[model samples]
Target: MLVYDVATRTVAAANKAAMRLYGYSREEFAGLPITELRPPEDRAPFLEDFDVLVSRDGPASGTRGVRRHIRKDGTRFSVEPTYHMMRYAGRRGCFVVVIDVTEKEHSRELLSRQADVDSLTSLPNRKRFNERLEQAIDDARRNNTGVALVFMDVDHFKDVNDSLGHGVGDRLLQEIASRLSSCVGPSDTVARYGGDEFVMVVLENGANSDSVAGGACQCDRQSEVIAHVMRVFAAPIAIDDTEFHVETSIGVACFPADGDDAETLLRRADLAMFRAKSNGRNGLQRFTPALGKQADERLSLSRRMRVALSNGEFRLEYQPQVDLQTHRVTGVEALLRWHDAEHGSVSPATFIPIAEENGLIAPIGEWVVQQACFQAQAWQESLPGLRMSVNLSPRQLARGDIVCVIQRALARAQLAPQLLEVEITEGALLNAGSAELLEALRAMNVDIAIDDFGTGYSSLSRLRRFRAERLKLDMSFVRGIGVHREDEVIARAILSLGHALGFSVVAEGVETDLQLAFLRRHGCDVVQGYRFARPMPAVDAYTFIHRFNAGSLVPS
Candidate 1:
């Protein structure tokens, strides 16, 4: 406790506690300026505050809140001081009470850190990232500079979690966080947004003479940072005894160009990240106005697709697969078609990706399986040995209940398991739990076909890891047959590899005699394309199947 003359701003008396707190005896503290208790830098502010308090009409008797104070030995600590008007030795003065709050302030700081940082990676969590991003944007505006928000997603990270386990996944994330931290400058902020996504904020200031012109320096700096980040992942990350070749898709959004606010910048950066992934993973994409439009359209389509299946707007069309040698209809690939009341016909290429992204693929996929199985069963008597091929999405397999879904669909339709061929792309095989799912399907006597053979991350090692009965030559290669020598060579190599592995190769998109003849000459087991027929409704497909087998639908 102490008393200081309010008008003179000088200490008049002090209690034992006050003397000990400031490392001063009562004699030494007496008549000293009250501002002496505060640090030198704070002394001027203290006097200004004192003037304000004394200038008020009423008595200044309230808390002064928390502040830093210096002791006689030059040591500093935090204190909360409260004062009240009083009379000391018959002079106008104020009695002050001081409480040390250094530990309290330290504890509060620790709590704040815990809330702002990710426990797994020790990087700033989304909350802190947002705050920092906003500050960066404000700074950029004031300094006539630019800021870049870089959004990144680990490519096929889910597969690692599913195949290796979550422990490995966590370790991988930690290592990624470390590498990302090492690549960025001290001024930049790196954060783990959530899951496999990470984000960084880079400030572009006039530090470089070239940056004085415009945003070009900002773009250059962002590119340099991104290049560093990419180089860090070039080598395989070793965790435990296993090595993983990790890849990331990056998206960059710039201030004053992509967006002005934190929220807009972050959202646009995420959109650009998706664009990078879609344009084939392990690349970078910059934000553009067109990407925003595409994102809005995707969201709208996703909303409409949610009620599509329930409203009976979805149906399956059968495209016949012809045996190359026999020229007989051996099976049909079930393709989903949507004829929206408002949008007319929506292409699968357009809506399927949106469905996958929004998680509507699960229910829609189940419906496709059920309807296709039912149709196959209905044609059992007419096309006795016909196989029903259905496309299974990677997202469906990721759900971990794909085998159960297919089992239930087959049971409901009473279709033979061997007669059902589930066609999946090479990309699907890269997912976690996919191998187990395929094994379970094989155990159930279902045939597995690797669709889109020459296009994905397919290797002999992966192909040998799982058992599949057929390989569908992707139309991209088939389209280039005779037109591109390279495509033809790849198509033949795929055919040879499939045959050598004891799998029948089915060529898709055989729209012309040249393509068909090339497949037959190359010993393709089956062929399906527009040359025979485009996809048709179940009723029309049934008639077409009969006509096809009767040789009446054969092209002259």
Candidate 2:
């Protein structure tokens, strides 16, 4: 609390509390100028405002909002001052009270910053990035320049998070954010767009807007920025004393060429990034018209697939697997087929990947399991030993409920577990939770086959650890058995290795007489392909199996 003379603008009196706050003695504070309480930069404005307040005819007794005040030690803090017009010892004076609000203001500022930042990496979040991108686009339009958006995704990031724990994954993301930040300029903005994905907006002044040879805008500045970003991942990232060679797929979309608005630019950049990943990852791509068309087609197909599943447009075809020595159908593999009302006979090769990407595989896979189990139960009346082999996708295994899904399917159909076989690719084994899922299936007496062997990076240690019942030679190797010597040698080695490890070898895509002879000579336990019979519907498969087993249908 203090009192100041209106005429002289000097402090007339101060209470003990005011002396303690200002770090001054009573004698020193008594005649101090009122402006001295404010910092030097604020003192001039304080006097002008004070003069107007004193000249007013009415009493001025209200809060003056918030202002900065310097203590005797020269430390500045925020305070709210309230003053009243009054008389002190027969002299015109003002009585004032100050309330410190430094801590409250600080808390508000911190909350504002936290809303714009990513909690893990301390980079700007997507919301802040979008806001800045809109502003950049506006500025570029005025300056006749370009703004390039770079969308990046960490390749195989889920493998890192699954194999290593999420703790290591978090640390790895932090390191990636730091490396990305080091590659951009002051004018550029880098942000964490969400999980394993980062985005950047680079201002390209005087960039060439003309189309290049490949239909891409020739933006030299953006090219340089992308090159710098690529080099950051050239070296291995070391985390917790372990080195990992991380890879990223980047897509570039420039303003006024790929898109004019922020939303359009972001979508196009995302489409281009997927193209980079499809071109085998660890690369970069620019947005083009053809890429946009492809994305639209993919989106249309994905929507159709969801509706197809609900409307029963999907069905299963079984390809018979024959025993080598007896030439009899031993088991059948269930293959999914889709026949759309508008576009008939869509190939599995085209739609399966889309299913996996859009997360439709989980529901589709469950339906396949239930149908296959019921079919196998129906076939048991004629062929008791026939096994129903169904492919299990890596996505399903990662969901952590695949074993229970299979168990429920088998129990509902009253099918014996021994008659069911779950076929998984070698690539699926590399995922986390797969081994445990396979072990759980094995515990229930269900057979496990490593499908498409030699098509992935399979180590002897993984083979020895998983201990699958069967190893299916991929069709690529089987197709080259008679023509390519390298393929023949690989096929022979795989057969020898499979037998040595007590795994029954099943040769896929065996279409020729020479290929069949080669596999029979090498002791391949089973074979399935066009040589026997093409994939048939359930009714056709049941009749074909009866005819083949009764020695009526002969192999061509």
Q: Pick the candidate with the highest TM-score.
A: 2
The alpha-carbon lDDT assigned to residue 444 of candidate 2 equals: 97
Maximum-lDDT candidate: 2
Question: What tens-digit string does per-residue lDDT give for candidate 1 at 393-434?
Answer: 899989999899999999999999999999999998887678
Candidate 2 — which residues are off by over 4 angstroms? 156-172, 206-218, 238-240
User: Residue 225 error for model 1, in Å?
Assistant: 6.6
Q: What's the true lDDT of residue 138 in model 2?
A: 99
TM-score of each: 0.82, 0.91
Error of 1 at 505 (Å): 2.5
lDDT of 2 by residue, 1-556 (tens): 9899998999899989888888878998978999989999999999998988899997788888999988889988888889999999998899999888889888978899989999999999999999999999999999888899999999999988888889999999999999888777666789999999999988786332331212234357778667777788888899988898989999989998999999999999999999999999999999999999888877888999999999988899999999988878999999999998766788998888899999999999999999999999999998888999999988888899999999999999999999999999899998867888899999999999999999998788899889899999999999998899999999999999999998999999999999999999989999999999899999999999999999998876
Total clashing pairs in model 1: 0
Worst 10 residues of 1 by lDDT: 207-216
